[model samples]
Target: MDLPAKTKNISVILQKPKYAGNIGAAARAAKNMGISNLVVAGSAKYDQEEIKKRSTHLAADVVEKIKYVDDIRAALDKFSYIVGTTARKGAARGPFFTPRTIAEKITAVSQNNKVALMFGPEDTGLTNDELRYCHAVVVIPSSRKFTSLNLSHAVMIMCYEILLASLPACAEIPPKLARSSELEDMYEQIKTVLTRIGFLNPQNPDYWMTHIRRLFNRTSLLARDVKIIRGICRQIQWYNNQKNT
Candidate 1:
């Protein structure tokens, strides 16, 4: 069966994944769940033969079309919404949702925005720095004693929920939002202006920026909203210049 139109906008990203077979298996899982866009971030080299061995002939097309980028930010810049998967949880890594919940949310966001589901390396899931790029975080439920999941297995579970969510008809589709690239630019400007005014600690600005990111992520900022915030930053910069003169 063909995937829902909105579901076609979803992309799966693997960051610094360690194994070729895992990548291949992940590709097959994504294809099985009607997700064709697969992106790999990081410079790790993998044996094509091993990858093909795992993906097999059924997912050859997915393997052939997999996108490769040098880093996670570049891989995700064009996407408007990004979800990061993690096994371990902490205060900083929080506000995590189940796969089903996030999948439903993605269904709505994917209606008008490009969505990315990002998974990290097999040994260690996404780090805090990497999770900063994600708008949301999802954790797969498992036994407490053995909470960790295999790389491809984790991909399969998330993909399955997204496919299930896409099966239903959606009544409301949101308007397109600002892409990650745009948001990042606005954030940089905000950070620079805020630091100039001492609103954010120059020694540890990102500590406070996390709160700012959380605020905007929850609001689901649109392109226009980003422009407004950036406009404010520009005005602040102008005021600072006037004061200096």
Candidate 2:
């Protein structure tokens, strides 16, 4: 496939952005950079007037093609690589990448795999807990004195960097991996079984589950990996039923 076609493999995701204008601007930015997919995660509603005004005629198609999902995890499954963009820097953000480097890497990966570049809401960037779902974090270097970027500006810079880089050819297509939705289902099942077996404390189930999610997210589990882990959860539940009866 050609380079622009490779860019088509990227999905630009907005996570609960508060303003419709930001969503519209991000879509415009994506279109300007040859990206086609635009997904909005979480419950935030959009104002049509704002979207149209910000997108203008240039990105009208993108505005029309926008997808809405209930949450960030729900929107992530199909993509092989998930990159979270943030201005914050610290230990908990996981592996960090400069915008330029990550742009090239993501472009190369998109040759055969779906890639997602996600942005958080305007008020707060992605929560630490929300970021656990990302495989890597991309930080746009800015003056530390004033680091926070507007939602649309951040998306624009990331997309622009991607457009500047060249995607390397893949010698072989990678194996089919589990989608985000499938992993989410597996997590639910695991949580259920663990809760039933008293492995997850009722008082603070999230504390333990948060760690589990982060651990597994780093692995980028394949379809088979998900199946094997889910099978173990099923067995545990079955054994519990037998013991109770």
- Per model, state how many residue pairs clash: 0, 1
For model 1, which pairs clash? none
How well does each candidate superpose onto the true structure, as a TM-score?
Answer: 0.97, 0.83
Q: Candidate 1, residues 1-245: lDDT per residue as tens digits? A: 76574766899999999999999999999888888889999998889889889999999999999999999989999999999999888989889999998887798889889999999999988999999888899989999999999888898999888878877777788889889999999889999999999899999999999989888987788999999999999999999999999
How far residue 177's Cα lies from its native spot in candidate 2, in Å, is 2.0
Identify the candidate with maximal lDDT.
1
Residues forming the 10-long window of minimal summed lDDT in candidate 2 = 166-175
Q: Compose the digit string of candidate 2's lDDT tens values, residues 1-245.
A: 23543777789999999998888888887787778689999986789889978988889998998889998777887776788988778777767888997777676667667888999988888888777767678888998798889887888898888777754444555555567777778888888889889999977777788778778877777889999999988888999999999
* Cα lDDT for residue 45, candidate 2: 74
> In model 2, what are the clashing residue pairs, if there are any?
77-180
